[model samples]
Target: PLGMESGAIPDDSITASSYWAIDHESYRGRLNGVGGVGAWAARTNNFDQWLQVFLGMVNHVTGTIIQGRHHHNDQWVTSYKLQYSIDGISWKTYTGNNGSEKVFPGNNDRSTPVTNLLVNHIDARYVRFLPQSWHNWMSMRVEILGCTMNSKFLLKA
Candidate 1:
């Protein structure tokens, strides 16, 4: 786990285009937090909204786990696309084997976790989630899957 669910990832590393309120702030977007309502909720439901995470260093991102607001059952992402960056300036969208931008399916209801394994793992320091379709409003709690590079590997790179 990348540590959002466990609070290992700091609040500074989590951000979003906009949040509904303080309680639904980006930093609250941790799986199982606040009885599951601690998800990041956009101020408005739109295609431009995004949730982002900075890993502090590059990591091999293999997959993602997402969930919606637990108690509400009304707000949740149904689908989304991923973009990753090494320097936070230039970004590349994750693509399918066909070389098209890949859209990952999100949760159907609140609380239940949905996991999606990447067909091509990404090595990145920053990752953003762009919601495509939603149940009512765009909201989500997420955790990234990957392993950190060992000292030897880091030195070689």
Candidate 2:
């Protein structure tokens, strides 16, 4: 399943701080991968704003791709924290100096998206994208990687 089409978005999937509106809709589908040019936008410029997606089921997440909003101009995420939660209540941050709250650097080139390869697998059902800094505005087209829980179970070696 590519995008959010395969996974399920629970009612709690969209608890962001705020949203930005324009010719485009500030919908979550923008992150669903179905939208080749679709994207999700945050209203506030503050770092507290975030977007979280539920994978419907647990998965062994390995990596991710973050595509900036490039309808005409560039809207890229500069710095952010990637977090995962198994139960959706408690969360753990990835990519940081302390190794707890990891801050991942975004794409410097607007024309292309950035791929982040994790050193280890994250087993969780919810993945959250929290923007700490950005170039233009906080907007993104996202792709989650790795396999389903069943695959994790069957492929146990």
Candidate 3:
């Protein structure tokens, strides 16, 4: 795991388009964060809302694990799309083997985590989860699944 729950990924690396409030802040969007409201909630519930993470360096991202707002079954992301970037400027959406954009299914409830593995691994330093559909409102906690690229491989890429 890239460590949203384990804190291997620092708080500075986690961010979102907008947060509901301090308690529902972006940094709290880590799997099983402080407990209640242990997820990031957007200021507005819409398709445009997003939660992002900076991996610090390029990693072979294989999948993602997601959950909804803690203890609140009504508030959770139902579906989302992933976009990745190497420099945080130019981005490319994760696609299927046929090259169409992929929409990953999100949680059905608040606590049970949902996992989505990529068909092709993405080598990127940044990954953003853009909500496509949600339950009550846009809210989620997430963790990236992958390993850091070897230093030599990173330099070559």
Candidate 4:
């Protein structure tokens, strides 16, 4: 479901990706799941016509960066964590359960608006985020900030 309505996903002007094929190596370590209730994802997969529907949920305007450049960010999603992997099948490549280190301009507890989340140096094939909690926040135009580190390849390819 990706917590979004069908009307939300603007399949507008997307004409070049349906037939474009990616290299096998470019698809490594990509299918890893982030932190979330597996049951919820399962329900989404089952009822939502498989997870393929959610592929590329966000519109990439800049070099396929996969940013969720929304109107404003006021979602309850808090405490994001990041992890890495190399082999694609196993997540052996890991650092400390990094939050602030992986994220720039701060650590956890970002209760205020951070002007910039300086995160351009990160180059990984797999990355995951676990929204620990959310505050009293809800909006129609909330954004997910950057896309998964795994999504960067969409641009490079």
Q: Give the winner by lDDT.
A: 3
Quote the positional error of residue 89 for candidate 1 in Å: 0.9
Tens-digit per-residue lDDT, 7-50, candidate 4: 33332311111111221111111112111210111111111111
Model 3 Cα lDDT, one tens digit per residue, 56-126: 98999999999988854468899999999999999999999988999999988888899999989999999
- Candidate 1, after superposition: displacement of residue 96 in Å? 0.5
Q: Each model's TM-score?
A: 0.92, 0.77, 0.92, 0.28
Per residue, candidate 1 scores C-alpha lDDT tens digits across 18-120 of: 9987688898788777643568899999899999999988888999999998665478999999999999999999999999999999998888999999988
Between prediction 2 and prediction 4, the one with superior TM-score is 2
Q: What is the lDDT of candidate 1?
A: 0.88
Name the candidate, 1 or 2, with the larger TM-score value.
1
lDDT of each: 0.88, 0.68, 0.90, 0.24
Best of the two (1, 4) by lDDT: 1
Candidate 3: Cα lDDT at 93 = 96
| Alpha-carbon lDDT of model 4 | 0.24
**In candidate 2, which residue ranges exceed 4 Å CA deviation?**
5-15, 22-37, 95-98, 152-157
Weakest ten-residue segment in model 1 by summed lDDT: 148-157
Q: What is candidate 1's TM-score against the reference? A: 0.92
